[model samples]
Target: HEPVPTEWTRTTCPYCGVGCKLEVGVAGDRIVATRPVIDAPSNKGHLCVKGRYAHGYVDAADRITVPKVRHDGRWRSTDWAEAITLAADGLRRVAAEHGPDAIGVLGSSRATNEENYLTQKFARVVIGTNNVDCCARVCHTPSAAALKHMLGTGVATNSFDDIEQAKTLLVVGANPLENHPVVGARIRQQAQRGAHLIVIDPRRTGLARIADVHLAPRPGTNVPLLNSLAHVLFAEDLVDRDFLAARVEGVEGLAAFMAPWTPERATQLSGVPADAIRRAARLYALERPAMALHGLGLTEHLQGTQGVMALIDLALLTGNLGRAGSGINPLRGQNNVQGAAVMGCDPGTLTGSVRLVDACQRFEAAWGVALPHKPGLNAVTMIDAAHAGKLKALYVIGYDIFASLANADVTAMALSKLDLVIVQDMFLNETANSFGHVFLPVVSSFEKDGTFMNSERRIQRVRRAVAPRGDSLSDAEVLCRLAGELGFGDQFRHTCAEAVWDEIRAVWPAVAGISYGRSSRHGLQWPCVDEYDPGTAVLHARRFANADKAKLEQVDYRPTTECTSEQYPFLLTTGRTLHHFNVGTMTGRTRQQLLRPTDTLDMHPYDAGQLDLRDDMPVRVESRHGEVVLPLRVSDAVAPGQLFATFHDPARMLNRLTGPVRDTVTSAPEYKVVAVRVRLA
Candidate 1:
């Protein structure tokens, strides 16, 4: 069925956060196949289904191989020079008319570390605006914000290699089997080795069915469920008093804060049985070193950051920090979500989460320009500003914003009001087809030379497997060339990817020691301060980041305001499926379509029976924001009165049901809970 390979390229998989090592085989610029590397530290020779067979989209016939500009709502091919000129001219016009603060530029988590660095640098150095953000604002911004508030650094406390040493694995709000298959296999193997497993989720995921204790809390009730676990730890005196005294602070106020959240009372609101809560807490605490990992299910809520704090409270209470087998880690959604934020893609900070004002002196001296002191709007606020006629232009890269953000109808309207929309991607996407004025064709990560940081904070190499198929260029080149047009090209004109990386090291102290030479093999972890210093695998070993002491915040469970009634009596949650990645832009063109063609609404049989429905029935699911029709399949994976669906299909527009209710601390929208009603179409 396939030919033998003439050459092979070793690189990282560009799909999920678990960046598995892949050796891609190519026959004269055509990808023949991909194989797993045995010695890869993250994956250990295992590849996910998508990683092994999803190369079909790389050679799809409909890819945009050249630059184009939309005229009169129609497309026309253009040379790179003219396209770049047009893009620069339009941006200049918008800036001249409404000032620099009126233009918004968005970076991408799917992009490389070098590219993301250049993206934010482009906005701050060239455009003179802080209106730049990434897709992480919709997912894990709260995870970082919460972790930073508790611990000094905001990332995973332990590496995935700790899976072998862990005596217990506490998984909350994540389904690794469907999302991170390679890691999921290792988790299953660990369970078989007699390690205890605790799963806390509302849905009966693949991990839950085999877990030692599965506690299904009602939607929007993570605080109560997690609080109940902490309550038991304190009640039974299972807490490590030595660990708390030596490493943590704020225990003096915790008794009063946790007194009201008893196991029995929390069970009434969270729906997790009191006995099961006590058992789960005991199993986790007694099992000396337990790993706590969570996903978007815990962060995409009205109390997202608060939920993260609550999860970390348990780990600290039992003295799980600074160990090989136990720590708190967030199962990042995007492959480079952690990297993008680390590279200063947010509007409020610079590299290493440093506020702009603090780093302004160093950057301004390096670039010979005055950095903007005023705080600019974030991604969500940019859209609201666009609709309100305050923002006029947008530069979007790699992500499908209209389809991926919450409240799709509002996003569409806000984008429609913008005067200029410059979209950069490899293919025609959902947003490009409708509102894109200039389309800059860029190569995929497989066709570029850069670095991607995985969920474990490991920085791996992304080598160029093949040359560009057509007139396409890398994202770094596009940003540099655009800067040239704007008369600031000399500073960003790097001869190679490594040269850009060298500049990143020179500017940021956190990644100063990580060079391409050292990270060539298995890659290096962050906090590598000097050249002689080896990277850190597990954080918080000798002392915590915050002055050798961690502080616990006091928060209470507050119900979401998006209440349900007779009109919309059911709750709907959205997530990704195993068959496709976000928005299905790349996977849709691949042969993976044969496995899963479209999205479907998964409902419990009892809920269907109450609505007088059956399997394969077309149902009209309506929320207060908008509605869509999807075929329903009666299944037991979800609890009764709860529905699940994937947002990979743009045609389904599942985000239409999600609203604007975001976490008060971070603006991450609450995608895990929504009130809706379903009926026969």
Candidate 2:
């Protein structure tokens, strides 16, 4: 057994979106143990299994801490200088020969805000391309797009603290218990305090266990169910006239638009009981103050954006926004997803609500250089373009684009077609395998000093716990060195992340209020002006950012083109398991974590019973695109005709079986509901 530590370092948990502040115990140079900070708002004196015991991954045996280069179809250990020159030369040569449009950059949501900002900036300014995106593109791009369309911003309007005061909590398509345990615990606490909990999902999830009303509707049926709830609320005269008139706009069109969605019609389409729908509507409407929390499950379908609009309609119909304990909240999957989006990870975006073209014009006037106006392809489309011989080089930072993208085989083939691929990551990831030219070893979160913005938009510090392991360097350091080598050192020179942040604040208006100094204490939330000016806890409180006003869109129900059939009799949904994070590169390094890993499929008892299978039975699950054989876990939490799988294990190859259908608005793949078939192996 390990000996007790003498001192503990106060830091944040490296897992989950909860962003719990952790106090890690260190003995000499190694981490011994970790505990929760007693005063952190996200987690007060509590820690999860992963957060408490997963520190070993930092000093794991299999970590590739040194820089390596792939030359002549083989990898060779290389020094920092050779690696940097090779990466810069390869990327520049590709851009010089094949036009800037031929290249794309993939940012990371798990990275610090400063790192995300610089990565996107490198793609846009240095590489002279608008082909920049992040992991949020796959998980919550629809949420950001839909929220911006309706609420005038791309972030959650409510904080986790609001749960304590909410009278009703409506969770749609999010299993916080397993995915976001701290948030789930808070919801449970609220449930124990008599706050009505309503869950809308295709499966009976962990959250469903504590929900007062769990509507296990069929997959892709969110639009109908949400619309019907709005119908019931409006028909019953539960609409708050005062709240609607004072706080919301376009109240007239909302009533006429939702008239077609009756409870009976919704029941016929969605499989939830008409009475249950009515009861849920009544409970949500009658409850004085309620909040709506959604996750990827709502935004990873064919009609994802439309479903988000329907949920907004329900919130507006019941006057559940723009006040204490009431707002539209999306529980982001990644740690810094909101910050990444806000800091301009999207190709057509800029900090402070500026579009690429418009912001470039403004930035050109400031920096004395014209920025590129042509918008580039998104992550998924970029791969397709590459496969079709339209795109050439790709510079990926922090993200493992291969496994994260839907249809791994298709993406891998696309990568193979690229003339040059530059992967800058802490490990030799699945995406890094496609690097034809160079690979740069970058510092992991533990070896770096930076700032990460939590889901609440709170900008917090990530102090360097240790020196750069092996020959690895921070992403910022690598980018700065590359910029210097390319004769752009004058522009990229910075002592630390703060100096880079100051440049961003000077140019980007949305980030104008935030500063490193202000963020030092208790982590100030964004839209923060000064030390005295308290940061905004909730957004769009008085009026939307749009100069005119909010106009509620008239949304109608439309089913996904792909549906369950005789050959593909089940709907496949993908998500994170309690034991692991996305792609399982970081968390997979731990021996204990691997022992309790998410290398299996979770299915309902009825589905397994019908297939003549028992718990832990090996089964081959297949879809049109691909298939995998995994150990079955028959759980009552999920419903029959639906299967849940996790992409945490590379061995599982779950993404191989899911494909191609993407949101037209965001280019995010519909990973939540895909038609598939399962059989005993």
Estimate, for each residue in 1-681, the C-alpha lDDT of model 2 and write its tens digit. 676877666666667767777777767657777788787877777877778787776776766677788878898888888888887887788888888888898887767778887777777778788888888888888887888888877778878888898999999999888788888889999999899999998877777877899998888888888988888887899898887776677777778878888989998988899999998999888986899899888998877787788888788778787777888888887777777777777888876547776677887675555678877787878888899998898888878888888988888888989988888877778888754467787776766766777777677776666667788788888888887776677667788988878877787655577777766656776777655667888777777766234666678777787788899998888888787888887778775465666577878888787888998888898888888888999887667788888888876778998878887678888898878998898
Residue 510 local lDDT, model 2: 56
Q: Estimate, for each residue in 1-681, the C-alpha lDDT of model 1 and write its tens digit.
A: 889999999998988888888999999888899999889999999999899998888789999989999999999999899999999999999999999988998888878999998998998988999888898899888888988889878898889899889999999899999888888888888988999999999999998999999999888999998998988988898888999999888886886688878989988998889999999999899997999888998999999999999989998999988999899888887788788888888898877777887887888887788888676788888999999999999999898998889999999999999999999998889888889999999998889899999989899999999988699999899999999999898778888889988888888877888999888888888888778878889999998776788988777989997767899998888888887998888888898888988888999999999988998899999999999888998989999989998888889988898998998887899999989999999
Give all TM-scores, in the order shown. 0.99, 0.97
Scored by lDDT, model 2 comes in at 0.80
Best by TM-score: 1
Clashes of 2: 1
After superposing candidate 1 on the true structure, give the runs of residues whose Cα lies further than 4 Å from its correct spot: none
For every candidate in turn, the CA RMSD to the true structure comes to 1.1, 1.7
Give candidate 2 misplaced runs (Cα > 4 Å): 434-436
